[model samples]
Target: MKKILLSAVFLFSALSYAQDVKFGAKVGLNISNLSGDVEDTKSLIGAHLGGFAEISISEKFAIQPELLFSMQGAKSEYSESDVDYSYSEESKTKLNYLNVPILAKYYVAEKFALLAGPQFGILMSAKEDFEFSENDNGITDSGSESIDAKEFYKSLALSFNLGASYSITENFFIDARYNLGLSSIAKDYTDEFGNSTSLKINNNVFQFSVGYKF
Candidate 1:
């Protein structure tokens, strides 16, 4: 990612400097994950749709900020290790949020800039499910014991971001960034047989995307 940042700085420098603050919109893809007690081994492609503004501080520096609707989460498998038998199950978690990122851009050339900042996200929705075991002749154990279907969004998180951006032209740019969650998402859980439990959901995010200015 640092390599990408370096390249972005050079690209921005080669472009012509603008007198007015630039404003535009962008839509791109995101590869995300959820960290913590439950391992999010599987990563899914999500979307980043937003608009941004660039106010030139000088010939080589600017304040860049954006507001976007981002979709993120993780996919994983669960199994019974505490039970008498061994079995596995699969699950998917989908989290939707409204994210705001404010960054400082340092130009290396003219059109390429290095970007870093703090990103704040507000939770909108969270959904999850578990797959059933393949074995038969046993009672269907509801995974509820391991998962609490309620109070999930109480985990809304905040994170720090470091990234890079490129201006393909004076009106369009593409950016890539990494977001490290600063908060932990804790949730109430119910075990299979009937047990109350708690698990901490890690909010770390690895994101890469492209955007354009109007």
Candidate 2:
């Protein structure tokens, strides 16, 4: 990322001198999940809040860059049964991130625009809630674990976003977007047997938001 930051800075400087520059603030809901090499996983509900600048390049096009704090992750469940015993487990992973997205927006209609861009995310925190239950010969046992999950996840993630925004008025708008992760979210390491193993997981998130321009 140094190159990305440099490019953002240059673009921001160029756009700052343009006409029709608008600033806005937004808050949104996120439905996030982990995809690839994982089973029994479901979407995790989260939130994101941020600010953005819309720099007009022409009558029907602009560059929108945003800084956001996002919460994302997934819920998972696993179960197994044998003739004499049954076991079940559930887990929820929480990942917090600071995200920057530089989007190119094209006005498709008078009040609607399509947006697509690359987003870079910096992981802030990771945690998990785990619960397990077992039944053997009519006896049952249950337990729970709260874990710090940062060690299992990578520090940075890259994703691409595609979405649309509709303007409700001159200053109010609504947005819907889907982010598809391009980088593996987990770290690579060697196992006890000197074999390399890594969890190949990527983030998938759907976002909906409302915004007001200032």
Candidate 3:
């Protein structure tokens, strides 16, 4: 993923010299979640800010490359029951990432365009905040904790983007996109019983943005 992103940057740089390039900055809202091998997860609200370069290759086609700082993750609640104890937990996971997406844009109309691309992400930080309660026989206990969880996850994430952009005016635009996860970001773990399990978690995000071209 790193190599692919690096090659794309070089390609974009070369194209910038011959193409009609327009640079822009954007700020956005992200509705994110986690999917795969997990249950009881809810969407988490986040934000993303980015810069992009659109290189026009023709009247109706262009290539856009973007660099963004994104916040993503999910909230979950679950319970476990056993003969000796009953336990319930609620957690919110927060992940920060630096992402690069190289998109192909097809102008469907003069003011509207469709976008599709591959996004490469490097995880910058990960943390989990949780509250839990356990009842052992007749005894009850409850607590909450905030922990750094970066080491438990893979540092690289890969996703595919599908969306559209509308040019509201000559220098202003609005975008709506869905980023679908294509790679698992969770690492394998060993349980207390010494059995190893491979965890699968992927990022699912919906984004909306407003931008101005410079």
Candidate 4:
């Protein structure tokens, strides 16, 4: 990992002298959800802030690398009823990550660019808040709780980014992107019999942002 980062830095430095380089910062809205091994899931609203360097490779091509702090997760609700009892639960999971993405941008038109990339994320925190209610033969109970869930997830995640950007002015732009997870974010568990099982959850996110170039 260190060697790879060093090589990237060297390459970026070399390219900076040969092409136009732009540095910028962006803030965005994130709509995130968890998929696989979970039911009744919905998107969670979050935010991301980032900085990037864009190096123009040609009249229509560029390479952009970004470092971002992102908040992502999902919300779920479940309910069941029987003649003797009824139960319901709602939960919200929050995950925080430091993300690095190296993107290739192709200008399809003077003001529009298509973007694709691989995003690498390092997990920072995981937590969940849940509430439950139960009724049994006219008896009722309700409760809420919060749990630290970092240990249940893996430390790293890999995802693919697909998006487009529209330059509104010389130094300003707006973009929308979707990140599709390629690696499972949940950890596996080993049993005494030497078998391993996992929840097989992945993170999916849609991002909308406004940025300025300097």
Candidate 5:
């Protein structure tokens, strides 16, 4: 196991050494959703703020890694009889780690390019809020209560990124990307009775960013 780990590290370092690093910050809108039992929560609106470094291995290839505080989750709602219950949860998912994304850039023209790559997100700080009814007064008075909960990270989740960039000058560019999450964020939950709980989370993010490509 140690040998395998060392080998993987060596290979990654070799690849990284072969690329040039481009540093930048990105802020974008997030349109997220929750799958599985949490389906009632439609597209949840959120945002992402982070900084990234793109390592250029060649003129058309690079490895980019980032640290971002990304907010992702869903909005859920249900009604019982005349009483209504609904809540939308947004997780201030702070991901702190090195994300090494090997990107393949194909230039459509001198100022236009398309990029495709895979991203691994390591969640650092994860928090969630619950707005529930304490009583059944008109479906709980239509009032709300919120509580902060801990979200445990199940290690790194795989994701795919596809985007296009337009460079107006040597130091300026605009990028539009679609990131698809490929892991289930559901950690096993058990009550005091030792029974398992059915709760799951997945990654689904849409990002649009404009940056200075210095």
Candidate 6:
């Protein structure tokens, strides 16, 4: 029993010493948009900065987990009509999140890899900028406002990421990814008519990043 235990410990130590672990930092740009129940929506340009750790499990496989500060949202326009006037509004919504993703990577070539994973995001802030115009008897009124939108959005979000990474050198790489939201971002609320409704918005983002490994 003592000899078996000693042998097991030696094997474990050998495996640990053979594993390759690396750490790095990254910065990127995001083109984000919201989908579902919205009209005339456009993509918003945002940015992300983060750090990550990659643990090599085999020659062709690795696990990477990252912590990132990400900015995402959309731009939209809509028109409404009343008995006396017609109005149009344009809005841009901004959301800030702290995101964590755990990815499984498989190397297909010596310097290129494919990764897919689940990501969890915690909302940090939300805001909306609005521009409004109304026409009454051909007279036009235009104004703008900025408002806090945090209460209208969910605090937690879930997404799936599909991406590829190419190593440019021993310590540098470029990454491209798409994130698809699996959970709705809107909070439930009552409308002006006392009917319960939700915005039913989901986030979609395409990200490009440059990273360095140490």
Candidate 3 lDDT by residue in tens digits, 1-214: 5669575776666496545889999999999999998888999999999999888888888888899999999999999999989999999999999998888899999999999988889999999999999999979999999999999999999999999999999999999999999999999999899999997899999999999999
**Tens-place lDDT digits, model 1, residues 1-214:** 3533553463365234544587888888878787777653787668878887786767887777678888887778766644445577777677777887767789987877788876667777777756656433454454432353336655456677888888887776777888887666656767798898776666656666666676
CA RMSD of each candidate after superposition: 8.5, 2.0, 3.6, 2.6, 4.7, 7.8
Weakest 10 consecutive residues of candidate 3 by summed lDDT: 10-19
How well does model 6 score by local distance difference test? 0.89
> Please, what is the whole-model Cα lDDT of each candidate in the order they appear?
0.70, 0.93, 0.93, 0.91, 0.61, 0.89
Give per-model TM-scores: 0.72, 0.90, 0.85, 0.87, 0.71, 0.82
Tell me the RMSD of model 3 versus the true structure: 3.6
Off by over 4 Å in 3: 1-10, 13-18, 78-89, 132-143, 191-194
TM-score, model 4 to reference: 0.87
Q: Per-residue lDDT tens digits of candidate 6, residues 29-125?
A: 9999999877778999999999998878789888787899999999988888887889998899999999887777899999999999878889999
As for TM-score, the candidate ahead, 2 or 5, is 2
Off by more than 4 A, model 6: 1-18, 78-89, 132-142, 192-194
TM-score winner among the candidates? Answer: 2
lDDT (0-100) at residue 21 of candidate 1? Answer: 80
Worst 10 residues of 2 by lDDT: 10-19
lDDT of 2 by residue, 6-48 (tens): 7678677758666788999999999999999788799999999
The sequence of per-residue lDDT tens digits that candidate 4 reaches over residues 1-214 is: 6644764785576486546888999999999999988887999999999999888988898888889999999999899999999999989999999998888889999999999988889999999999999999999999999999999999999888999999999999999999999889999988899999877899999999999999
Question: How far is 44's C-alpha from truth in model 2 (Å)?
Answer: 1.3
The TM-score measured for candidate 1 stands at 0.72
